[model samples]
Target: MDITNFVVSARNQALLYGDYNTYHKQLAKKLHNCRKRLNIVTRNRGKFSKKEPISAEKLSENHEYLHLQLLTAERAWAHAMRFKAVHSADTKGITGRTRSHIISRLDKGARAAETLVNVLSDASTSGASDTDILEARAYASMLRGATQFEKQSWEPCLRSYATARIIYTALSTSMRGDIFKDLLSETIDPSIRYAAYQSKVPRTLAIPTIARKAFPSSDSALVEQINKLAPDLLKKSDSDAQKGQVGAPNAPQTITWRSREVKIEDAAIALALASTDTATALLEEKLASSDVTLPREMAAAYDEVLIASQDAADATKHAIDELKEEGVSQNDPRIQSLQITRTAVNYQMISWRIGRNRVLSGEHDGALLDSAPTTTRKSKKDATSRKPKIEPTGRKISRLKDKVVLYDSTLQSIDSIKELPGVAADEGLLEQLEATAKYFRALKSLSIARSHSLTDQSPNAYVLTKHAFDECQQSAALFSKHGASSSDSSPRNIEIRQADIQFLHNLLKGELQRTRAIVQIDSQRQKAAETVPPHGGSPLVQRLFEYPEGGANLNHLVDFPPKMDVIPVKPLFFDVAWNYIDYPGKEPVAATTPEPEQKTKQQAQSQKKGWFGFGR
Candidate 1:
């Protein structure tokens, strides 16, 4: 019958477009139509009539009767919600009379739903399927729980909500829709948690465990029905909860940061921490089993650990937020401890993130520009006789570009660690972080230099390589003096070793020398190109620029064999200057006087003209 689907769909459609008042009006119209269809409505101003209740025996006659019963219950529920929606924003809160009125309406709805369940569960008269009966039962329990919730009856509310939770959980697994899952997250879970809190249940117990314990097992038939739907729903939760417990033998109960240890009071944080440890071990196993694991594959392995660590961090943040929301002072012991826990979890999360980036970079943190291993071919002839394939210049530079991105990410993660709480106060830790940043920066510079070299930017590559060498020297010096504080053989971020530092130092040193030599050769070539003319001039001038490849030609003086050549000169300079300067045929015009006839004509014209140029 999809009873739950029908209810949830109606609620969503009405609430999405309008509030409960609209829903109430719509339900009323439907009920009126239903009554009119049954020929039970008063006609032509006749006396008013009350609709009769739907009987269990009559429900089998037609499915409309079942719909009528559901609509009736929903109408009552919507009416109460209408009141709730109206006064929800009132500062004074619900009055005593209004609370009782809302509870009364809710009670009627719950009773109607309970009556519907009883009618649906009858084997002889009820025509509904087992699933329909189960849905009706869960719906009734939820309404009853809501009624008890408003009445401040925590124990009964907890039990009622637990019943709904269990049924919905079973239906969620078997059903194909998200209605049950949405109900659990958006409604059932929060109510159960709040009621459990009021009932003095420990906050550490998960919703599933609480639901399992509070479920009304006294009803044998309901238990049987639930068991049939989910055979191990009740049994499996026990073992799962035990396995999820922080007190379990395998689960970690405490987290240590710096010199202080804090007990993990939150179960979610402990579970996440435990999963992170498991993922770390699994990553190690995968890395050990494969001799040439691809960077993507290693990165994929690290994702699990990173996600677990992020969850732990988020859980810690949630705990701190909750404490603060309750007006807990920062100086409170709980809040202070949570702040420390937050820092520790955040540090761990960023460490794993940086570790992922480090793995994505090639061996030795990309100090050596090695091609990524893309194939796993084995040779039977000599077992170790595989030949190295020379990659193209473009492909090598492309790989280096990828490594540079990874190194940049690693550096960013290190900087984020410094921003975490309590990290700045520890000078030793700060030095370690700075050294780690320098190490990644050196690798980044090296990758950039290699790319520049591949593109024939010799000077730029030389400068970058030199900078990289200096960073490597600084990082190596720091590592040599203090070394990494952590001695764990397993890989972790900010865990630089002496051998790796020395290896990078040697690498950058060699790269600096090689790039400097290339730069010098390039500079000499440029100087020779500039000095030697493009056109073949005298062999003596060309020989002065560079040594003759075929030995000095003593017989050749002007060209290779004394051939004729044109020399460029300024032939037009004298011609251009002659135009500007006075010459015999072209004397300066200003140096000559005007003609006598023209001068006499100008005087005559001036005498003939009147004042202001009027003609006389």
Candidate 2:
């Protein structure tokens, strides 16, 4: 019988047995013998008779035989399929009954292909080329290796099938027999595509090794299969069963299972709890550090820490509120601490806010003292009436009273004007006025002065002694007249000096008060000075009225003449010489004791000349 007939009959028998072990053993032995014969046929192909015996009819017969061998090899694929099923079932620990049925089918298919390969190899080795011989040997070797299918190895099966399909397609219709040609042309074996699709393995624990290999070249059906399987794998992996688990395979075992949905409320609650723990820890740290006595720098740092902690706590509170709105329990420790932290933060914020305001207010008050008229003692009565009262309430009040007493003691050290010495009399009116003016300038500059000598530039030192002598006289005269009316027996002259000093003091005080008023008004209404039309006369013109030196005009006062014109001239001769030495150079040329009458006449002439501006 032909190899094709043997393959068909053996395949039927193997199916009947429904087990592959016996079939596999017989197939392995038959395939080994076929391979040996095919090798011999290849070595003898060149020596085959072409002239006498090797006719077209014989070549056609040989082609039919090779075609039958291919058919048998194709039929052997059935055994591989059966073996795969049986192995899969066994590995999965399926019941023995099902496993036996699969094994029986696998054995029958293996034996059928084995017998066919042996027949084809024996026929080809007689005169076939090395290529045909190798093809036959490859087919037989593939069938005998039952372990490839048992191990679920699909690569060898795919390779062999591809080679066989290619060769069968390339052969001419005349070269291959009708039955083999019909099988190759009409029948479609979808095993390759199906295997590629199956390799996607949606729920498998291991990554789809076959799927990666196919990738873009893989059929759409395969890609769809992968997409369908991947979600199931991820879902299974992320299930509660895998919680706290490590090193688990990334893919799922079964693709059929669905994933459980995550509870958002639970997640939110957990987040809130974690945030509360952080806020509590921060607060505790703050409180612990606060317990220690802090240096100034550390105190500043602590304040910053407090502010930061409060902000964190406030944020936590806001988060907790959101959590509660999302249906988390308000009674949860995190939620409870949220309220506590908010309260603490509010307390801190309020305390700091008030303290800062107080400090700022104090600074404002101090500044107001310098700029506002309200702080000034307007009059003596006002100064006495507005004196800060002493109400001893606490130690602060007692300390203030003690300070007042010390201030009063210092005031007593200020001597009365009567006890001071009087100034000299020679001081002229101009000198007095200049001294008074200087005292006003000094008082304005110093802001405090008890007497003229107390000033750095005392006017008394600059005043001439003659001026002092004159002032002493004027003061004495004034005292002599006013002494009887004066109630105090102390010195009248000293009283005059005191009056001058007091005038300067009052002038400076007035100017100072004016300056303060300007400042206060300026602070309240910071408007620039408006240029207004002069109501009567301009201030510049008004100032000219107080021009010094008593000039008739502003220009004249600025340019006064020198004192040389007022100087008295010295007498050239005395009165006797003027009477006796008349015409002294022009006396009669000395006629010895010249007449007294002549001398008298000459003197009269000289006197007349001196009196009437004519010479005798």
For candidate 2, lDDT tens digit of each residue in 203-305?
A: 1111122223323323343234334423332123232212212122221221110121212122212232333334334434643564422222222323443
TM values, all candidates: 0.79, 0.19
Best by lDDT: 1
Tens-digit lDDT string for candidate 1 (442-527) = 98898898889889999999999899888988887777677766544676565787777888888888888999999999999888
- Residue 162 local lDDT, model 2: 38
Q: Candidate 2: TM-score? A: 0.19
